[model samples]
Target: MIDPSENPELWDFLSSLHSGELLTGTIAAIEPFGVFVALDDGPDHPLFPGVGFITYPELSWTPFNEASEVLHVGQRVSCEFLQFDTWNGEARLSLRATRPDPFQLFADGIEVGQELQGRVTEILTFGVIVEVADGIEGLIHVSELAGTPCQGTQGVVRPGAYITVVVTGLDRQRRTVSLSQKRTSKGSP
Candidate 1:
């Protein structure tokens, strides 16, 4: 769907690209929301400097505190084309897609009732997010966090503090893990 009335050359160029295809580009800009790529084979964007774009979550398969920790401006990279971003007139790209998905690689055999040790990454009023595995963050709902006492808990869960939790649920398609601090066996790892 090329808007030929606009930048016909740009639209035509993007129209030819397909999902899952590998595209090479340089990191043109990094914003808090996403990273921009100036694709080697793509036309100049009328607004953004690059026609290829990657959101924060697509930057890596590893856990990163910030996008700059994983990627940098001017760095060359090969990303998988996800789709044409019609709203932004850009190609939605995935840097992590070029790499193996950690969830699919590791979560296939994970079962409920498994105990895991993870560092608390975020604390919300509803629950805390923990990383039981690299790139995998799951929620310990407030209901699940109740009645669990830990050295790290001084009446509250704090980020970067370690906690043991039991797997309560898994959504493979969504790549989310549900955990319960209350269900974990008393032990430390």
Candidate 2:
């Protein structure tokens, strides 16, 4: 029997793949959490049909309701190689990393105390996450949710509701934007 480990071609192919390299592939499978890609003109994965893989968050810069909304089986894609997931024995790929980050753009154009309108995407005990722009969401802490103290986010806002908020803080490096729903006399600059 031929020993698969002894194949020089397999070693050469695996050796050629490096993190941060761009690779072209076809979607071999789609799961709730990620997508499996069959690399074009590349050696097959020892365990999977393709070597490239993209997690849910890495699938797109824009928020998606489902994996099918962004990718379908056999769809061609170009993705950035993040790393080789040793545990899963697959290449960790990112489709969003290949696209422009909307948060970066929003941060560059706005500043603290600026009033912006956004849609509430999620309501948590501590805060409400609002989508201020495409692919850009900001957190409105419980303290900032309203003028008066509230027991929880449910008292302040609901998902899909539109609200006006003031930019309270920002962390460009971390991609975090803090917003306040409390009404303020000061106007946005």
Candidate 3:
């Protein structure tokens, strides 16, 4: 049996966790290797002498330009514990691997006709990806951006711009969110 007092730091860390612990930590450092977090302090401390770690596979699909962009020193973060891995002393952490993603908050709350304010994150030939809320990205297609028959999505909206839009549909399975700015200008869709 593992004695908790022998390794107080590790014990304290384990004490702060549960089966599916969701907590926030700050980025203490980011190396090409992985991200390190100052685990002791945050909105929720998951460990006593708080520390965080991120490996290669965990950074996938994080929308970070570089590993550094994924996190920065002193940057706060949110993640869930996959469960304690005593076999290897590896407590797998996931910042983007939560089930029933928190993003669904916006999806679940939005109605087809409800108006919303969204910030453009990326522009594609077919549509613009707007982040209506943190982790919640909705798309405004070329046709839905404007009713004037614009050239493309770029013609109607630009990245970093905020626009008023309407939720057209919610695809929970595919996680595809549909929005329309033109619907509001044209008086409802």
Best by TM-score: 2
TM-score for each of the candidates: 0.71, 0.79, 0.53
Better TM-score candidate (2, 3): 2
Query: What is each predicted model's overall lDDT from 0 to 1?
Result: 0.85, 0.79, 0.66
Clashing pairs in 3: 39-50, 39-51, 40-50
In candidate 3, position 183 carries an lDDT of 81
lDDT by residue (90-160, candidate 2, tens digit) is 67899988888888888899989898998999988788899888778999888776735746666567789
Writing each residue's lDDT as its tens digit, candidate 3 over 1-189 gives 444455566656755687567767677666776666555442222332234566655754334557765556787777777666553233556766654465466667878888888888899988888887776788887878674664676456778888888889888788778888888855422
TM-score of 2: 0.79
Among all windows of 10 consecutive residues in model 3, the one with the lowest summed lDDT is 41-50
Q: What is the clash tally of candidate 1?
A: 0
- Report residue 153 deviation for candidate 2 (angstroms): 5.0
Best-performing candidate as measured by lDDT: 1
